[model samples]
Target chain A: MYLAKIHITHKASILDPQGEAIKNALHRLDYQDVSNITAGKYFETTLTSDSKEQAEATTRSICESLLANQNMETFLFTVEKVED
Target chain B: MYLAKIHITHKASILDPQGEAIKNALHRLDYQDVSNITAGKYFETTLTSDSKEQAEATTRSICESLLANQNMETFLFTVEKVED
Candidate 1:
């Protein structure tokens, strides 16, 4: 079995309201140097596959159909062997 | 300036319905090897500080106050120097 770490972030062109809110809050707190911050979702998924290629393919499918909104977000994943 | 990547995951004792749903979906798709998955939130924050220590401290305060739910989730952060 393999475990996949998926990181999803908004496309550079997309507007991220959540990130903006956090940014504003930071400024209010006097952290004036902070900028260009973005917030997104992280997923840890488990794959039931003996082959690395198969696991990767399965993870990709999940990310596309369920995990991410392709029009607004971009996702990347890394697969690792699960230790016994 | 520095960028921090924050990851928030449910504590081991918590029940994660989202992760459970995903796990069931994988099983329905015939991916039987998947198990023990948990979903989480990710944040990328920018800190306006000249010193690493100050930046880290600010990040911790943010995480504690507005980012993660201390009772149910655990958080970790990685700080890096942003390139011009």
Candidate 2:
């Protein structure tokens, strides 16, 4: 088995409303320290596969096909072996 | 400025419907390679802070107070100084 720790975020050019909302809210709460924020999805995936290479490939496929929008978002993940 | 990468995930005891749905979808698409997934939020936050210590502290506070649901979700983030 393998564990994939994935991080997905909007492209730098995109405007992230959720991140902006949180930033604005922090400012309202007197936390003017926070300036910029980009929010996205993180997935901790476990694959019951044979090899690390196969697990990594499947993870990338999932991220590209369903997890992220290629036009506006991007993703990176680390696949690690899970000791049974 | 400092960049904080935050990852939030549900507790192991929790049953994540979203993750399950995605897993089912992958199976239907014939990508039965995926077995388990725990989905959560990932945030790329840029904060204008003076010191690394301050940045780390603020990041933790944000994660604890606003980012993660303490009841069901747990969060971890890395704070790195950004080059101007």
Best by TM-score: 2
DockQ of each: 0.69, 0.86
TM-score attained by model 2: 0.94
Candidates' lDDT values, in order? 0.85, 0.89
Model 2 RMSD in Å is 1.2
In terms of docking quality, model 2 is: high
* Candidate 1 regions with alpha-carbon error over 4 angstroms: B29-31
On lDDT, the candidate that comes out on top is 2
Residue A35 accuracy (lDDT) in model 1: 72
Compared with the true structure, what per-residue lDDT tens digits does model 1 show for residues B1-84? Answer: 788999999998999999899788867876676665689999998777788888898888888888889999999999888774
Docking class of 1: medium
Q: Which ranges of candidate 2 are over 4 A from the true structure?
A: none
RMSD of each: 1.7, 1.2
Superposition error at A66 for model 1 (Å): 0.6
